[model samples]
Target chain A: MSGASTSTAVIDPYAPFSQGKTIQLSSASPFLPRYLASTLPPHTSPSHVYNTRLRGKLLILDNPLRESRSAQLKQERAAKREAEKQRRVQGVMGRREAKRLGVWELRKEDAKWALFLPIHHLWLGYIAELLQLPPPPSDDILHSTDPSKHRLPSVPGTQAKLVKADLHGSILSVKRAKNADLVGRGGIVVHETENTFKVVTAKDELKVLPKRNSVFTLRVPVYAVRPGTGEEDGGPMWEFELYGNQVCFRSSERASRKFKFKETIEL
Target chain B: MFIDLNVPFPEPIVYESQFTPSKKKQKQKPAGLTNAHASTSAMAVVPAHPLERLRVPDRKALRERVEMLIHLGYTIIAFTQSVQSKLDPAAPVNWFDGGEGTVFRDLDPRFNGGKRGVVQLRRLNVVLDEASEKGFGFNAQTTQLLAGYDILSLTPLTTSTFQSACLQHSLPSSSTIHLITAPLLPSPRLPYYMKHTLVRTALKNGARFEICYAGVFGDGARNWWANAREVVRAAAGGRRDGHEGVIFSGGAGRVEHLRAPGDVMNLGTTLGLPHETCHAAISRIPKSLIIRAETRRTYRAILSEPKLVFSAVPAGAAEDGGEQREDGKGVKGLMEILNEEEERSRKRVLEADDAGEGQEGDGEESEPSGRKRRKRRRKNR
Candidate 1:
């Protein structure tokens, strides 16, 4: 008992403070046996501390007898997702800006922006379906003529529907702007306000660009993106410009806005 | 695409006399003389500005002709108004602005009936006779006047007019003259010879020659055969495709003049156009002309429409190569976080397997947190 080295960490169970209580081999803290290290504020995880002093004795980190914290976190996330889905079905989208989503504000992305590519694809399909453009240009010409001349753009009757199409998730670049900083900024539209767009650029930047005095180069694939399959049906890319000043309306208000071909007098 | 680009719209009755005829009658045998003859005989009579205001009888006749075309299975029909009087270039060009609606007001533009609907098209045929050779009002300022027309056809009555119509007015860059029809009704032969160079130049510039089958049944039946054969021979020699750029339309005035498309194609064969080429003239050739003519309103006669779309690659990677150099602190990227999450999940999965023996007996109640619950129960028991 007396030959123990002076430098040795000989924690005594019978010491006055440790008597009738569990040994304090690990540093005392409010949140550890819970191992909720990730739950703490970022950069505040107790990494410098011996991650767990009782890691060997208590076997909490690796033992089969106790539950894994990671599995517990997965359960919590799954539950949250289910609740979100229920809220969506009930028409309780957490915000009025988006028509069909709950607690689903898609403003910025520090990560997971690539995940939005699929959403962008769905937007392309939505437009193609709304426009009802002809079957994407084929390498083979249409040998079988319908012998009908009134297939003017296939159906001129659908012009009204095309004028009021919804433009969510469209990829656009600022072509002209009053402010030079706003020019050349292009992105997938994450959210649209009455007079602005919350865009997540390819650099994963969320820019809230003003709509007035700007011309946006909207890029669209000629063909529709097939749903559920992440591949395109192969068509050339086409670009057209939309005057931002003309489109300064909330997404809901845009459907009711009347568009005309009258020449603009302003430069 | 069975198209009849020229179903002659009825001449509007201008009650005001064009040239009083000096009120001096010869008292000769002919009791029925049309107003046009009196004006032409007066010598000093200036050509009337082709009347546009329609009376009831005139509208009724036009409606009847359009219905006849629809009944005869002509899918697309142009109510062609032949403007014989030269237009004053300085005057307002919207003369035929709402002519189609005025003529077919009660009828729907897409008035569907037997087989399919008759799509109404308004055509403006400017007759370039010797009297108006200086300018038939074809110029930059006349686009407003031509905007109302779905097709612009030219009728060259003189050799000078024919040369201008073929070489100058047929250019795809600036001109809108889609069809060139020589006035074969009164003329013995085309005022100008159908030279191969002129024919090829016009054809190259996307001008189509129209062979009016209605002329064959008119007073000029004899003249129609001679003029049409020359046109077909010259236009066919211009292009490799024997009957390449010739379309058959009816410059029919009376109801009886309108013939079925099959009969018209048969009439084309009479002009020595092959049976296949004749079928194409009424079907394929005219259909293409209609599409070309529709381009007059576009930005620059562009065929494929342009629209906006997303690029295949990410815009940052496409435009700039410095995506990774976006300035910031030691920011955790997406891949790093994702990999860490995956590692933790794998660890949890392994732990579940190790604890599988303890929970296997009554594994049916297995919640992910069941292991902790079971351990607590053992301690209590």
Candidate 2:
């Protein structure tokens, strides 16, 4: 009995305080289990205090919990790195596909050509570029008018000028044509021959319109010098209705012909 | 400006008398040549028929139809042809050949004369039916070919197709996809798949929902009305969620199918759309669509500002050094000059008003007191 008591006392330092009592004072303490469990090594079994006491001393220097937490962090970082690589690869592939499908080319070309041009003038630039012709001269003089001067006719002899001037690059709108085909169409003059004028329509279709029997109203932006003022007069753009049947000469030949300007008298 | 975005090309008219013998007999009777013996004798006298009788009246009919739309105050009309397959890309496209003495010549006789409002032509919607996977499969080549068209629309058969299209197109990145909302026959209500959430996503992607009103004029008026009501409900939801991507258009095939801007607006109101939104659906929304289409087709065309061309200055102005000042000038000069001129005019008007007030004070001193007394009486009452 004395040897057994001595061994118990050596193994447990608090054995002398808890003799034969069923309810010991140390068992009721809140800090005992929590502190022991926290002090125990992560790899050791947590349920039995006897096993922990046996193995806890050997594992005291080794922090298995900290090692496990670090390993888990490394695994998470690798997954994140993999996801980032995948995203980058996807981005590159998308760009390549866009280029292959001409989407990139379209966007780039559009940006390069349309960067400096205005929207309303897009048609003019488009037709000019397509037909390999210079765009129509800007209407600086006509648009430079004060509100009061806007009501006055900017170009007094527009009808006469239209009949005599070169009709290249002029915007033509069909007013009245004996042929039903030339009634409501409008386009920019691409090429003018003796009998027919090639025009690029708004839809970008090239059409050869015969210059016979069609009544065309041309919107020619003209700069008119004010009489006696010696200053450039800013006026509204001029629209003149001319009978195509009257002018049968080529655009180049029209400049030399002294044709009578017969303006359509609107009833 | 009102825009009728979908008008199918009219079929060539075939004269009934040319096909049926019964109609020929009726025509002969009307001409007082019912007697078979007399008719035979007349036919022998003039073996060659008159040129007028041989002429086709289809051109006249088409012209009249376009004119009727113009008279009804539609400033723009898009003649849409639905694209069915890859083999027929140009099938739905109709190039108005008015300039080349084709059938469309008389369609807008006064268009260029500056006598009426401008009637701009556009190819509105190119419908892609993604119902048949084999026939209407999304082909990259076809999409590229359709780039020539202004607006491209997709009509998905199933909800999954709609979602897939939205996912693939990335509607927010490109404003190319136009959602067509036509009446669903037999079942007028919105399909279960067309959920509010899906519509919200589409709206977020910059996809516009189109409401074609031509279906209202035909036998499917009831169905169309029901469909339109559901669309309005969806639009209302979108509006509440701070999105406005709805557009109203006339998908008119014939002249009788066309409606005035006011009438269409009234129809929109009946469909539960707000007054302002209804007006915008026809005018502002369609205008933006046209601009988007134009930009899509023309690479060199930008929609930022109006393009200006520099006309040769007058010799006199050139000498005055005004031309030099505007040599490298852009939109800035034009806008600044106009604004300065407007400010000067406004100041002059104010000065005139001050002078007029002085004159009025001298002319009528008693009238001013009477006016003040009347004002005091109104205020007291």
Candidate 3:
């Protein structure tokens, strides 16, 4: 009687059974066993079995469960609030980093560089500072001395030397040029490159003069230190008249170049 | 010395327009306008004055005109030749040999006698109506003009044209720019063109505003008068602000149109220019312009303040060497005086220290206070 009851309970009522054929079919149908295993609760305790069965019914869509619209909106709002909180944390971190790095002070220095240097030179000077190299000459060097005392050297030998000297902060006057309009104009040298000088004239106007086909007389001041006292003594300034085409390179580049000391060539 | 900075020379060739109608339109027979027609015809029939006649004078006539100008005491006369454009090849070719050489040649023989007056050949480029289509190109035209002319005067028709001509040039600082004020007579007020900022820039760039007096003697006298008054007001305003760049000229096209320097000065005074400024316009300014033109012609000349430094003279030459030595001495004397003054001050300070010490020692010493102290100090020294 017990055997008969066990067989009846183990067998599916809806499935067809035919002795040997049914056994073969049951062995071949592995998916049915896998599905039955998935549906069965692992635990036999009353509370666990009840919960597992409820989850199985929900997974199978036997119960048509839906979330409320207000609850969905509240979830979306919470996600946005979390994202905003993360952004605020990031902003606070950024401000703290900027403050620690003295970014505002750096910006103030950049502003001063923008006022004085050309765009390319500004970057060069900035990079130079980063590399801990010597900074390029500044306007303060020019303003420290009396400009009126600065005169150009008239001697030919001295003139050649003066032409090779760094022209930054020198007072320049156009002596002669093919352009008649440029004759006899004077200006202060603000910047210089390989082929041009950026000058600020007496009228407070900036002018760029090409170093080709123009003659310039540079008035450079000479400052000396007293040998004994080591005090600065204002020396007599010298004047130099130069053919612009001959000295059309940066002072540093020209210094590295080798030239015949006494080559008798007409400029 | 009086100078007429602008007198149009190589008299203008009048070409009658081929497009004029073959016959005048018959007076419209206005049905009831007979009275108005009669008055209009009467106005047109009035006899033309001798000065009003516009005739192209020959070279002889120009010489006679110069003689008349000399008689009227114009010590310096800048004969202005109008240059049209480079596309007009004739104008540039005419400038090369015909303009400067011919005028000077024509006037030289007549003025060879005791008169030490000068005749300057100047160029006037009237850039009217065409500046809008093509910007004032610093091309072959400008280069040729700058190369050929002694003094270049640009008469831009509009304010923008003026700015482009004056401010946009590469070398505005050294350029001798003259602003012609005659054309403004039939148009707007002078201040419309001569804005304060523009005037300041012009002054800074060494540009001089010129007033041509011959415009006043033209057929449009009323318009000219109004223009002249406005120009004077603008110039006077500039002067009051301590920037004086006004120059007077008689841009006479013919002998009859010419006015005396005295008359121009009186006109300047009447137009509200200060007396000294009126004199400077004719004398000092023109002289400086002549020097500038002379320097422009000679490429080798080096202009030093108050004098020109010539490179042609040998460094060791004794002819003008004394002047340089004298200048050196003068500078050295000034320096010596300064040094002496400094030494004297130092000596005074040392004497003050000695006096202070002597006064302190007097209380402790047993010698006569003042008289013996000097002898004692001398002995101690």
Candidate 4:
């Protein structure tokens, strides 16, 4: 509470009404509208400044404070934030594990990889906004006959997709691997570690694929419908092969890593 | 699409006489610098000095020439380096280090997000003489040495070299050589007769003949005219087979010699090449040649279009996202038919259940009949 509002708590013995009158009629109270005493005929509203009826009863109005208003608001905003923080789901790591998804079977009571569809949908929305991917071509634009208007955005080239773009939530399959068993197993990348990717495969089994002499085929939607739409999809996915040898850093580290063009023969 | 595939990287110092160097160390330093970068990059093995080995090209002059070519709207430009004899796989040097980012650092014009930047290519032109006839180093061991270059061409001075260039060294996937260029400057005539069989075979194998416009602007203009005209007639003028294997390039040794792409196409007219054909010579013909050369990275030299196979779409109700519409209108029509069939089959099944209500409910008999109906539906689909 400000000093002005707090002053109301103390009672003046001689003139209780004068104390209230001072709060509304002092120089600081110019923020409120002023009434003309000369225009009043008799005694409808009480006399504000003179207090002609009761003499020898003087009161002082409190001063207006600039800092206290903002201070009070700051305290309320922080309290609101603390309340919001309490609602976040807690996990083994910490509170933010609210973002972490449970096993696919536990999610929908089905062991099928399809159970993690909601998480996948959330990931698509996350990646689409993160990459600033352009909106999908509308039905009208797709059916348009004019070739000149067919403008596919040129930003999502192979270099941008492979070099440093985050691959945490993208769908990836092993195109080739040193261990022949990992030749074709692919799924949504649930957890990305330093040198291995913890993938949730279509069979709903988690596969820890090492980043050795392995080549991963990544399919990014050319135009993906943002999540929450009636039918969310990766409308037209463009396939790119990422040599595992090139990307071996952790997900956070890869964001700042620089990749140079190596000799084609070496691959 | 406009490309000058033969911009020669000239030596910095060209002595008054063809022969002597001031000292051998000057030549050796550049060669070592080249090999260090080349071994890492995919470029052919460049020998210490080739036929034009007397002078090292001017770096400033080459940079200025390429800048001028980019301003002239040449989106793709290959810095041409010629070798005297066959490359030794044992001690290979890569002289193409300066054509790309390192030398042309900050060279890109900062508009359109640099998407229209020049595609700097490294081309090795082997000036095939009698010594190279012994061996052009087209062996399996030379893949590393030869793979360094993007476009490989042969300047055949003899009939035997010409025949080998067309027949043997034309595998774009395995072997590096695809372009066949001859010295069409100041010669009394071509060193060998232009055989029809040799020209057709070379064209069929995707080998293009280049006529350097830089040669025409010099003192050899007269000889260039006759030679260029003969090459064009031999390559594209004969029958209506759509054989346009001849390409025009700027073999500019100095900055002043380079010309714009449109002006070069116009000059090709003086050599009896039609306007449209000459336009393709600089644009579409070389574009396909350079793109096909990427097949060198593929196994068994197989180059084909790739099709996208979407991960399987599972049971419809269980899917999160909508299923893919595989081509546009045709798939929609197929989907409509499937929807109508499902409705009709569902109505028939309901009617069958109603009719069986009066009869004794035999679970086994009904199950077989239902399985048979589903089987027939699958066959119809």
Candidate 5:
């Protein structure tokens, strides 16, 4: 072994084994000379070498100040984050004001606008209401939740058997089975035929026909129904909805609940 | 000027049989500071970062992208589970193939091998819990493992823990959550504890949530969307009055519609749906959609379809705070179903007895004949 290699053998990789404890100590300077001894070898007197190093001498770096690479990176990130925060706050304000001035176009803003545009729309609408901006001429269809009430003539029908019930809707008005009564009623409806029906009550059934003479409730289209399990009795159970004239349907996957519902309604 | 009308149209190139595998595309880091919290190991291995921001889908591009993922270390099963769980946890977490195997032989196919192997599950669970405890916005909840699911919890880990794990040759924090469950929406019919645990780990660590919904138009047209933007937009638009600033779904922004964040015990009353129906809806919607209910705001919705409107009572119409439904609708427990079945059988027996009584013509004589016939049939068997 080289003369230097011979000395390195004395040092321990896992060091500071005291009593029953094993503490890992840095071995970086195990062979490196103390600052006092550059032309000479490091003697057993570490204290003597330390004192000698205090005096002007040919130096050996026993423990150099190592760079904290991660610390520097953290500082840089903090600076960047501060800058970003300022930018986002400014953007929010700018967008809000511009919306107020009625000159804001979604296309002109940066991609961040896409993130904030929906929020901005809501805020601006609120602000406009507070400022008493002349209400943009409102239409019944635009605001009314009961557009069906204005058109549909009440149908004379009884609620069908309740298939399923939730906190929101009940699955009722099921056809194709034997005669059944409205098991119970909070909301009830009757289907006279496949195409003629009324929402006398809010049963979670399909409103087969037009609510009014001309206006029709939306039902999901037939083609949208996913091919069912093909049970011998009935191929599959399908659900439909009519958004005006459009219909939507979904296939059932009872096991995994991966039902595929398709919307036939155009936005 | 005469136009040449008979010019032969160029034949479309038919490249179906000749599959030209494209060059591996570069993996993309999610939007924002992907490095802020990601472990170096995750960054190194999973080049395409999944957690930082929204991933809008390119349907045409999915096949190739998935193929590339297969080329990477991920198993097809992992990929499918990741995608489906992201869409809806209730959806059975399925895969294209059982696992990923190299096209060539002589390769170690398992995730871990002899020497310098990855960390084990027990250690992983410890690390994740420690990290979550140390970090802000990180919380861990331990509960009974749902049947057919893994037993673990999803919790956010600290950045420092992430760094150390990478340096220590342990599994990435992204896969730390062992048993996860998606938030509820649509329907809460299906629950997979093991798949959910994986999803929770991925999400808590940093996986972006995406919903892949196949839809069609009113004209019988079909299309699929890989993101939740369109659904959110439409659902939000349909909200009556003004929205309560937030919407909740199953998980985090993964399904149709949105809901408020936080506990939504009274979502039905807030949304103007019957309480039972609302509860049912919340339970059913998979962990795909993020859900929250307004603290003080209530929105009234007009129920147009009668069948769509559910009654609060289990049996007939009952007042608020009444007994369960009479028809046994929405009864969900082992005991309840067993009781229902017992009741049904007893009803059948009673009906048979009634039929026997109605046949009064020599009923006493008929009973003896029936016994004789049964004995004869048994003997023949």
Candidate 6:
């Protein structure tokens, strides 16, 4: 007993005084576990100490009570969460912007190529390029939107493949005359006849005034000037590569004998 | 957790008084012509812009124009043999901008029977094949063949009360559609939905597709493959057998799988000509096949090159095969000659009548009358 007392004194110098105080105090005196020291209030008085001690014991001693409290809190939180979810569901339920499905709704890609109107000309062409539509008429000579007259891009001897090369910055000149033979020379032949024929020349287009019914000739194909004017007066010109350097001729009856120079200037 | 029912709650409604009919005297009934005139006035307001108004061009006039356009080296409607329109007789069907318009009811002689309030519509369908002894005869040499050729269909929901009972009937697929705006050059500007719709119609109505297929590499090889399995797989037996041949043989196997380059090349060669000529024909394309050999090239080839596959008659010949011999005298039998002469005389008289009416009515206005002489024939039958 003496040895134990000496060890207790070495471990805790206040153990003997603490034991004596517990025996001397009534039921109101504080008695808390070591774990509750950090959680409890710092008041160290004898009065109300038992209430603090009871609270500490209640928190530590019973597992069922703690479980019931936690479960009740979880239930309340779950109810609140479900209410919010229901409100969100009603918010988006009646929406006008939502897509209305049909028996056959067109896909975005399919809708792009539906028609050829002025508004969709450029965009439609891009879509056509993406879809890769086939060229019309598989045999014989090829035609444009107009299907009657078959077009030979170049003379038969010169089997050159023509394509659209350049449009802007290309110089085009227009000429009106009584005779078809005039304003055409070299490989160029008078393909057609009308009151006017606009000679679409290369970058080196020249300006020449006809000398009193004297026939002047050019070395390029001349086309009748269409009404629509662009940056270049020739309208949209396609590049033609000759299969061979063959000269071709076209015959046309003169419509207007009298020729007055209009806008036959450089453009 | 709560699952929301999202049921809509009803609000309160207030009672309202009933509307009482007025006890005013009835107005006098208008004359038939006045009523017609009033309806015409209303219809005129419907399409204010002249260009936006649907013009029912005379079939003959349109055909002539198409022919002229074709001759001029422009690509017009190539697949169609003819086009006509069914519309309300009361509505002013103006095919042109000004007067002397080719109205549908006024032109077609049979339509004169009972057309009143029906708004006739212009519809265009094409004849892709003709019936032959060997079965349906298609343009074999033409590489760019238009598949899924079907009667253009339309459904009219409403019309004025003045239309005749026959006119109020459901829209007919025979002549309710038309090529209002034809394709430009090299290619036709048709929407993908339109193409899809056309394909669906064809598939549902015993039509086959002439697919422009290309094959690409699967194992990252340099060779390209053809993806014509859709065409072959969707076809009947795919062989040149009898009617039972329509059942595709490759359906049992995985047809969508990427085809070998050699097989595609062989199929292209087997299909008469290379795909380069026609929009739908198979053509060999040298493309990098490493990533996706089957998807590099554009697969939609709808347009076709025009060819002289059939004609009403040889350009210079009559009903008889007279052009075979180089002799100046006609080779036709006596009866054939007599018939030809009679036909020529009849044609001349008709031509004279046409010339006389040229000022009052353009040649296009008379085309609807021509349909009375011919009858529509079903191809499958």
Best by lDDT: 1
User: Residue-wise lDDT of candidate 3 within B1-381, one digit each (tens)?
Assistant: 567777776533221121133122123223343344433443343222211112324545766777888788775676676644212322222232333332543343222332333454555555534534264434545554465555666666666666655565312323344444436466545424556566566555545678887777757677777776766665555435553577888777688887777777888877777767788887666655554443333212221112112222221112223234334221222112222334465679999888878878755455456768877865873
**A192 in model 1: Cα distance from truth in Å?**
25
Instruction: Judging by lDDT, tell me the better candidate of 3 and 5.
Output: 3
Candidate 1 segments whose C-alpha is farther than 4 A from its true place: A1-267, B13-52, B90-95, B99-116, B237-239, B303-381
Per-residue CA lDDT of model 2 for B1-381, tens digit only, reads 566766665432123323334344344233432344334443333222221222245445556667888889876666554544223322222233222212232343222332443343434243334434344433454654445344556555455555654545424222345545433443666444566777777666555677888788768788888877776676454434543667887777677877888889888888877677788888767666654444333212211112223344311112222224333542222122322334465679999989887877764776778899988965873
Model 5 agreement with the true structure over A77-188: per-residue lDDT tens digits? 9998888789887874456667787652323223232343233234333323332333222344223334342322221111011111111121222211111122122222
Q: Identify the runs in model 2 with alpha carbons over 4 angstroms from their true place.
A: A1-267, B11-58, B85-113, B124-131, B134-148, B164-175, B241-243, B298-381
TM-score of chain B of 3: 0.61
- Can you write out model 3's per-residue Cα lDDT over A119-204, one digit (the tens) per residue? 32332233223323322233354234444433322333333344345555445666545564555554546667788877655454
Give me the displacement of residue B101 in model 1, in angstroms.
6.3
DockQ, all candidates in order: 0.06, 0.02, 0.01, 0.02, 0.02, 0.00
Best by DockQ: 1
Model 3 lDDT at residue A257: 56
Worst 10 residues of 2 chain A by lDDT: A111-120
Tens digits of per-residue lDDT, candidate 5, B78-165, equal 1111221011112221111112211111121222221221111110112233423343221222111111111122312333433332
DockQ of 2: 0.02
Error of 1 at A74 (Å): 65
lDDT of 1 at B79: 73
Query: Which structure is stronger by TM-score: 4 or 6?
Result: 4
Q: For each model in turn, which proportion of the native inter-chain contacts is also found?
A: 0.14, 0.00, 0.00, 0.02, 0.02, 0.00
Better of 1 and 3 by DockQ: 1
Per-residue alpha-carbon lDDT of candidate 1 for residues B67-116, written as tens digits (9 for 90 to 100): 88878877667778777646655443333454332245334333212123
What's the CA error at residue A95 for candidate 6, in Å?
Answer: 86
**What residue pairs are clashing in model 1?**
A147-B1, A218-B308, A219-B308, A219-B309, A219-B310, A220-B308, A220-B309, B112-B117
